[model samples]
Target chain A: MAHTIANKQKITARVRRIVGQLNGIERAIESEVSCSAVLQQVAAARGALGGLFEELLEDHLRQHVAGAHLSDADRQAGAEELLALIRRYAR
Target chain B: MAHTIANKQKITARVRRIVGQLNGIERAIESEVSCSAVLQQVAAARGALGGLFEELLEDHLRQHVAGAHLSDADRQAGAEELLALIRRYAR
Candidate 1:
């Protein structure tokens, strides 16, 4: 609920755009566009999608991490999990 | 709506855990734990957090990118955004 409050709109809009981008990529592959051009488009699409996740992740931290609903052990685990994810995917 | 359908519960649970992890990190700092031990905890926290994002990101791609609601351009942008976020944070 709290996470939704932070990003429902932006997430929705971004998701809509991502859907459109995927269609473009399909067309690009079908039309056999230049490899460079295709790759460029692919890169762009990934970046946009990643941004959406990043925003959501930040919201999770603000809401859950900074909140009072969890114990110290749980908070530590949560932070560890988050840090791991950032390292793995953001790399 | 669809995104929520895919991950509402898992996300909520993970957030709760992340909250607890944060508190643990704070305690570790206050207690003056060894630097290496602290770093280890920090690393663990980052990884866990990153995994949560990675899972959510995958869900986003599955729901929005793979669905029939978007155009080619939007999907490409989504993919690019995802890739960039992965590279940036995973690093």
Candidate 2:
């Protein structure tokens, strides 16, 4: 999406932080950190991932599905695509 | 937790896969892959992370909060800890 390209730096930073968090979990496991601590790390990473998803989803909806210039058929296709993604994600 | 230790390998593997998925997202961004494709990868990684959280939470509930031998006080504390985690994660 054009919006994603426009926000590429922000999205990349978010993704990098999530990668760091995931790596932290691995290190915690290797070091035999307490389960509760590791669980917290996992939850933090999960939340970050969810944030990324939400941003991208919003961009997709705004630019592709609900854009002012989109034809009705294009809008319908975008909506179906989004719905499929939501189903898969929610699964 | 003792349960985490018992299942260390499985947990580590899951974490590794999540890291790989995250790396894939970064690569996709760097390569200027379509937004939809990148979004799908994010969703997949988020789902995997959620699955890991679910596994760890179940283990925590079974061994710490709901264990047959746990004292009432310990059970209460465990439940509180879990609630805190859930709140943080949901936020």
Candidate 3:
């Protein structure tokens, strides 16, 4: 339904790396890494996650909701779908 | 490189739908849609965006970061990548 079929591998790889980063943070905490350095690492991870978000958002905007292919009814459904998702996301 | 290359079309579609949803919001505002109705629609759109984010995050986790293919060095780089993204997201 989404791009998951085509890009599952790539996405998984990024996430796994995030996992490692989390591990790295654990190690940093154990080693008593400086607050600034640790914070930097945390920030980096957050930024990376954002990148993933941006990529997906961009894709969604360009193809499904406003793409040339969709009919008016489909478009309304799309909006409804998003509204549904937002409810879950907020939870 | 993220999964954009492989799933650009699918991702784009989702984004386009989100745009439509935004348009709907504008229309509702112009019509003076009820507060509850407008708020619900707004919430829906927000939730939809979150769906896009979740999809990307899931992929990042499954394919790129934690996948079996990457080396430790690559994994670390992935975390660094996320960290970089987080900084931008916060800004």
Candidate 4:
């Protein structure tokens, strides 16, 4: 949480770019662009979103799961949280 | 491409929902929401994007690569195109 707060600007910028990509996809579809072109844009957006997820996942692991200061219970909870997230993301 | 044109409304709706999800993420960040909650939203958006990609990929495969009417050369070209797209998407 603190890590995210510290990196708020960076995260926000990434989110903004992803939003723009999604909008481009919507516009392409609305205008009946070539399927290949629209697929390319969708892939780009997915990749960008994956990048953001990886960044957040790394932060969460460092702060919550792998911190040297965390107790056993806290680490266990963090592991469960991460596992649940991975399952959802994989779906 | 024909497949996409036929399903334009469906694809557009998915894109619109994804855009809304991204906007929600941006707003959550602006409001200083919990990292876990933000992460959940991000994962949901990623999953949605993945679903769209899978849909497009399947359509491309069926229409371009796997059509029985296609010649060997055409299938080869489709395979190459799909390979390129998968590489990009995987990255």
As a whole number from 0 to 100, the lDDT of residue B16 in candidate 4 is: 90
* Each prediction's fraction of true contacts recovered: 0.00, 0.51, 0.00, 0.46
Candidate DockQ values, in order, are 0.02, 0.49, 0.03, 0.47
* Number of clashes recorded per candidate: 74, 0, 51, 0
User: Please, what are the lDDT tens digits per residue for candidate 1 over residues B11-52?
Assistant: 899988988887898899999999898888888888788778
Worst 10 residues of 3 chain A by lDDT: A1-10
Off by over 4 Å in 2: A1-6, B1-5, B68-71
Candidate 3, superposed: residue stretches over 4 Å from native: A1-90, B1-5, B80-91
Q: Lowest summed lDDT over 10 consecutive residues: which window, candidate 3 chain B?
A: B1-10
Across all models, the iRMS values in order are 14.9, 2.7, 16.4, 2.5
First chain of candidate 2, TM-score: 0.87
TM-score of chain A of each: 0.73, 0.87, 0.72, 0.84
Summarize candidate 3's per-residue lDDT along B1-91 as a digit string, tens digits. 3332224446556655655665665565455553334445545655565565556545555555677988887677666655554454355
- Minimum summed lDDT over a 10-residue window in model 4 chain A is located at A1-10
How much RMSD separates candidate 4 from the native structure?
3.0
Judged by DockQ cut-offs, is candidate 3 incorrect, acceptable, medium or high? incorrect
